[model samples]
Target: MMKCKINLNPKMLNLLFLISYVLFVFSLFNRDVSDIDVFYSFTIFAKYISLVLLLIGILAGTYTRKEILWFIVLLCIDFILFIKSGVLVFIIISLFAFHSTKIEDDKIIKLAYFTLLIFTVITFLLLSLGIFNDALTNRWVGDSERHTLGFYHSNVLPLIYSYLVGYGLSSGIYKKNHYMFLIIINFAIYYLCGSRNVLVATLLLIGSKWLIDSFLQKSEFKKMINNILCVFAKIIIPFLSMISLIVPLLMNHIGFFQKLDFILSYRFTAIYKIIQTEGIHIIAQMTNEMYFDNKIVIDNGYAFLAIRYGIVMLIFLSAIIYCIANKYSDNTFVLILIIIVACINFIDNDIIDYSCLPYLIIGEKYVLESFKRRGNNYE
Candidate 1:
């Protein structure tokens, strides 16, 4: 078994985090830039930058010794995918992986790191070279807008999110001037693009996190259940608001940002629109490549893996589920993230996005981290 070890200065480790944020920042400003199929372009580049940071960041995580043969096999997948994403980023990350000292943790983190490393590479290449963008945007010959010189796309989503999340995290007050406007802008972008998956994922994440948090914070079973109900209410808040919309919704009732809240209220309608298009037939056709008469919706992460890879693979792939359940079961955010992944795993382009894979792989470590931070007083 190969040992997972990457030794670097603390400063360097912090720099990696800085770089990761930089990548995310780039994605944010680039999100709205004019380019055909800009959404897909931004997603790839943003993810690519995230992947590179992850590879370097692996050293800071809880990674243990390798499992001989499995490690080699996974490494091969990483190699192939890396070749696909970008040779340069792949080489840098792979080199970092090879040279860095392993931190202490479960096997899942190690595997997740490897899988993400490969996914990052392969995805980068596909987006950069594939003719899909040109075809989708009506630029079969040569679309300059389709390809940004440094990367792809001018405006990006991550940068926008960074500002929103970053401000909220650091300063309690949201930049009402910026994301106050962005709330509608992003909602519009999402509506036009028919990107209902992210919203559904967000709701799932919210519910799970809320439920878990309630389960933990309450002392009595009744309180726990109440908290869980509150979790449900937090999620239902938007849906309920939609109902309120028809009945004269009062501005003073739901806090602030009524317009953004109203946008969220329409989630069901947007989701229904998606349901009409994807149906079962489209799912079966796409899965035919992997199996016979597979009606599974491979667009979702869970479905994608189950159909092509089967139950056995999913068990191994999602091994961290038990870890998270047992330890950080009370973590509302983690719960939400898990739910988000699970719900959308079967709906969107889960196979390509490869977002949930990282969550699954790092689930245990994150669970433990969340649990550790919760303190002993957690009831």
Candidate 2:
């Protein structure tokens, strides 16, 4: 018997991955396109093609035992959830893309930032010309209304703008480049979107990074502070995890929490209602019932995941993120990016989008690299 063999060029595969990722990002804007049927079909086709290319890469690439084990575990959880096959495929593709790609992380970061910058510029130009005004809506803040540029809803623009800001800051900080212009552009867009949460989150993320970096520069205090932080992180992370799991249940009875929820646009209240009325099994199936008679919207990403993919899947994902963070503890850029995204997720369901897959893929690649280093050291 002859063994079947297939070979793929790493460069070609990487190029294909980049192209597919760009297409996927473009597809996100398809929501605003009027001819939904044709555009939606094209978007779906682009996604499937990306998945196919990623599948091929996975077949041709080598994976560590740790990677394979986690992949199988996630696949099992996905099978149980069973509603969003596209999401499952996305997870698998991300894992494989991380394993198979030959591009350097810095290059990938630059590409992503460049792409976002282009999109922001183009969108701004279009908005200036009065294009997409039909899709624009007003976002209420206190007693006034603000414009949301070129988005069907006010929530989406802020999420998108925050991502750009996060990536811009990450790249700028890492490269030690002057990114003030990029930050300004992102802030202007966020302001126009009328998302106070996004503005606050972006500033907090940037400020947090700056503070950490400044503190670490103090040679005498650096080591001691690092040790203290590590210990605190160990305790606080698990505590926070438990808090997240129970926050929905608590939102119903807690008066102070109810007021806070109302301030945050009733996001927690809506999620609590969904879980209470629909049961946890609602996560195992995809439905629009979370809209609460097509009136309420659950904007929290964690809540969306818990309701759309089940508690088990959500826990699994949280664990995966925890593992990645633990593995890449020294990479401040990755850590900051994750933290920013987590903050944004509290206000929007951006995690469910295809754009987030690249970050996960990059983190997974780091995990695989760590595994290889461990094996090498043991040998």
Candidate 3:
């Protein structure tokens, strides 16, 4: 019997991965374009195609014992979720997490940046030209008009902008002036779209980076800052998770919690109601009943993770992110980005959505590199 062999070109595989990722990110732009046949069809096709290519890449590659072990663990969890909820989100994310580490970080970042930037610019232009349908709703932040600008909601566009700002900070690809200009752009996004949480998060992220960089020349200040950040990195995710989980439970009885809930646009209240009505599960439990105002929305990301996806999945994701943040605790900018993203997740649910948190791609690369340095021999 002749041995069968199939040669794979590394460059070709990498190129295909980039294409697949771009398609997925591109599909995000048209998520709300379901009314427009051409754009809607293209977005749906892109999503399915990206998933197919990702699966192909996973099958073609060889996994180490460590990777295989991790996959098995994730698969078991996803299987439970499938059985309980009939949702494929967890499994899909597991595949992406496994496949993402195989591609070069720089290639993925560059392609993702360009793809998202183009989509953002085009969305802006189309909305400005009145060519795109604007979701002119007053549901958020009181009777003020909220503009989605062709996104899934008013918050999404600014969230994407915030992620781009985070990418600029983590990559060190933008200068001080560029970030300064971004502040102006972000304020404009707030003005036009009225997503206050995203605007606040973006500003804090940029300001934090600027202050940290400025303190770099002062050795004592830098050392002190790094020390604080090291501690912050350790607790950020857990802190956010705890607060998100706890706040909702307190929203009704406590005055402070009520004010906080009002400030967060009743996110805690929504989470509380969802938990009350639907109850919690060990694995994810799908909800056909709408949680808030006839809409199935969970604005608190950490709460969404724990409540909707189950506490087990939440802990698993939080641990993965916690490990990554601790791994690069010395890198000030990376630490700050992770912290800020965690804070944003407390206010909004989209933690694993790449368009909303592209920094996860960077985190994924770091994990793979750390594992490779260990030679993948460990159980």
TM-score of candidate 2 versus the correct structure, residues matched by position: 0.78
Top candidate when judged by TM-score against the true structure: 3
Displacement of the residue 73 alpha carbon in candidate 2, Å: 5.0
Cα miss at 242, model 1 (Å)? 33
TM-scores of the models, in the order given = 0.40, 0.78, 0.85
lDDT per residue, candidate 1, 1-379, as tens digits? Answer: 2223766665676467445534543443233334435455765677577666766665444432432233344456445534433223323333233322333223323333343334334334555665223222212357332222222322222222222332231222333244345345445534433344444433333343344444645545644654464454234323332332222223435444355445445332333333344332211222333243334332233334333333333443344454544443454444444334444333333322223333333443443333444543463
lDDT of 1 at 305: 37
C-alpha lDDT of all candidate models, in order: 0.38, 0.59, 0.71
In Å, residue 208's CA in model 2 sits off its true spot by 3.3
Q: Is candidate 1 or candidate 2 better by lDDT?
A: 2
User: Model 2 off-target regions past 4 Å?
Assistant: 1-4, 32-38, 62-76, 83-103, 122-131, 134-136, 140-142, 173-179, 212-215, 224-245, 281-283, 287-296, 364-379
Q: What is the lDDT of candidate 3?
A: 0.71
Best by lDDT: 3
How well is each residue in 89-121 modelled by candidate 3, as lDDT tens digits? Answer: 556666666767666555555666777888788
In candidate 3, residue 2 scores what lDDT?
A: 17
